[model samples]
Target: MLIHGVALMALAVAALLAAFSSIQKAGWLAAASVAPVLAVAGVLAAWAAAIHLTGGEKFDDHPWV
Candidate 1:
């Protein structure tokens, strides 16, 4: 779970950078690629929030300590 969250964050960062790059060098179609990236980021963020709100331990049923 820990690794999953970190990986998601990394993906989001990569997506953001790609989106910025596309916008700088391409046009509307390239910019459209960013929508999926943003969606992934949103989903990951929501997942993280759900885990936090439900008590972090619930993520994979393991206690921090």
Candidate 2:
């Protein structure tokens, strides 16, 4: 999970840089495409980190069983 988070964060950073470069060279259309990609990467990284910190137990755990 830690590794996954790290990888996702790295991807997010790369996407962000690409977005910045695209905006500078092209226009809003290029940057807009990158925005969602970066956002998803960032969210995935956060979710992975949270799952790792929570000891792999999700909210759906069958504790009553």
Candidate 3:
């Protein structure tokens, strides 16, 4: 899960750079190809992760500890 979240963030950063490049060199349509959906997903992922990490601690079940 940790790796997956990091990978997703990397992908989001790459997509954002690509979109900005396309918008500078090409047009809006090209810029819209990947970033919009990925951006939305990235925001949702961050929100969920924030909730999970912060709100989750209160409900944690530590069997091993």
Candidate 4:
């Protein structure tokens, strides 16, 4: 999940840069499409980190066992 979050953020940044650099409709569309995806990924990443850090719950009983 962390990896995904980082990847999505990178994609969003790239798309944003492209959108700003290009005045084409497709560039704007690509940026628009990725905006929400990035937002959701960011939220999930933060939520997961919060839960993990707070010791909310664990999916595995003994991860190494």
Candidate 5:
């Protein structure tokens, strides 16, 4: 989960940069295309972090434990 979260966050950051560049260069269509990816990845990353952090204690049995 942690790894997944990290990966997703990285993707979100990249998408955000791309979206910004698209907007700055007057490429609204490209920006619009990447918007959903940005939103979904950003939200899922947050959710993964929250689940991992709150799922159990330090000694609990889990994949990342």
Candidate 6:
């Protein structure tokens, strides 16, 4: 998870740099847009991992019989 965060941050920085160099507004917008999604995905992954490590289940088990 830490590695993923670091990678995402690095990519975000790279994207920012690329955005700065590009002439098209869409290029800058496209580069800026991916960072937040990556960040959010990383956070959600860590959260889900923590829950799994703590023995929490994503769904409740109910006996039907």
Clashes of 3: 0
Which stretches of candidate 6 lie above 4 Å from their native place? 1-30, 57-65
| Candidate RMSDs in order | 7.0, 3.3, 5.8, 7.3, 6.6, 7.1
User: Could you give candidate 3's per-residue lDDT for residues 43-62 as a string of tens digits?
Assistant: 66665555454433454678
Backbone clash numbers for all candidates listed: 0, 0, 0, 0, 0, 0
Query: CA lDDT of 37 in candidate 6?
Result: 60
Q: What is each predicted model's overall lDDT from 0 to 1? A: 0.64, 0.65, 0.61, 0.56, 0.62, 0.55
Q: Against the correct fold, how does model 1 do in TM-score?
A: 0.47
> Stretches of candidate 4 above 4 Å error?
1-30, 58-65
Query: Tens-digit lDDT track for model 6 on 1-65?
Result: 55555555565555545445442545656657655565556565556555545555566678783
Off by over 4 Å in 2: 29-57, 60-62
The better candidate by lDDT, 2 or 6, is 2
TM-score, predicted candidate 6 vs. hidden true structure: 0.41
Compared with the true structure, what per-residue lDDT tens digits does model 2 show for residues 1-65? 66765665576567667656777787877668766676666566666666665566656768787
Model 6 has an lDDT value of: 0.55
On the 0 to 100 scale, the lDDT of residue 63 in model 4 is: 64
What residue pairs clash in candidate 4, if any at all?
none
Better of 2 and 4 by lDDT: 2
| Winning model by TM-score | 2
* Alpha-carbon runs more than 4 Å astray in model 5: 27-65
